[model samples]
Target: MVKFGYTILYVEDVEKSIEFYENAFGFARKFVSPENDYGELNTGGTTLSFASKNLGVQNLEDGFIESTLEDKPFAIELAFVTDDVGDLVQKATSLGAVLVAEPKKKPWGQVVSYVRDLDGFLIEICTPVEM
Candidate 1:
């Protein structure tokens, strides 16, 4: 059984990414490197780390090289569980987050809506219905 703790995303600019997470999602900066190459944001117990692409190479050894030919912008969808789905959606919209999908009740009895963050990552905010 593996427990999830954190997810790291490579960003073009760490400062801008941090500001987005803070202003949009209400995540606070928990830790940051002195050079500002990487930092962690805390949202409840989950931690999301943002690392700049240029500084990410520092983690690799000298003999190691990453192939840029296959490198491309990747898309990831993150689902966030919220008690008040409707309120959260409204708040997210007011914070300049783009609403990709309006909140809808799914067949599985969950209310969900999709939104895109500043970096174009899809985020699904959902609330489970009573069985």
Candidate 2:
């Protein structure tokens, strides 16, 4: 059966990205490869992983492109659920994540905000849905 798994982000430094998630969002580190080119984090039901840019290049013949500090984030985004969007925004920003949008209340009564991770990956922090 097909099921959703983890998302892997290509980064310059896997260890630093791993630390960023740990300090910014409180995700505990799962492990890092012995080669120091890959790392994973315990993000509840699904994992969040990071791979070195070199690894990405080695894996893809055409070489995959990724968001850069000089470029805008990719179209897709990773959404994180939290009770306090403001607090998480502060934490993410303090860890070098640039704020894309400020927290705002949606018509459905949910608060949501957007930010870009150190690698320019889009991230959304919002209150947990009661459904």
Q: Pick the candidate with the highest lDDT.
A: 2
Q: Where is model 2 more than 4 Å wrong at Cα?
A: none
Candidate 2 lDDT over 1-131, as tens digits, reads 98667899999899999999999999999999999899999998888999999999998879998778789788899999999999999999998999999999998889999999989999999998766
19-63: candidate 1 lDDT, tens digit per residue: 877876678989888888898998877789888777766665453
TM-score of each: 0.74, 0.96
**Regions of candidate 1 where Cα sits further than 4 Å from its true position:** 57-75, 129-131
Model 1 TM-score, 2 decimals: 0.74
Alpha-carbon deviation at 108 in model 1, angstroms: 2.4
Q: After TM-score superposition, what is the CA distance of residue 44 in candidate 2 from its true location, in Å?
A: 1.1
Could you tell me the C-alpha RMSD of candidate 1 in Å? 4.7
The 10 consecutive residues of candidate 2 with the worst lDDT sum are: 65-74
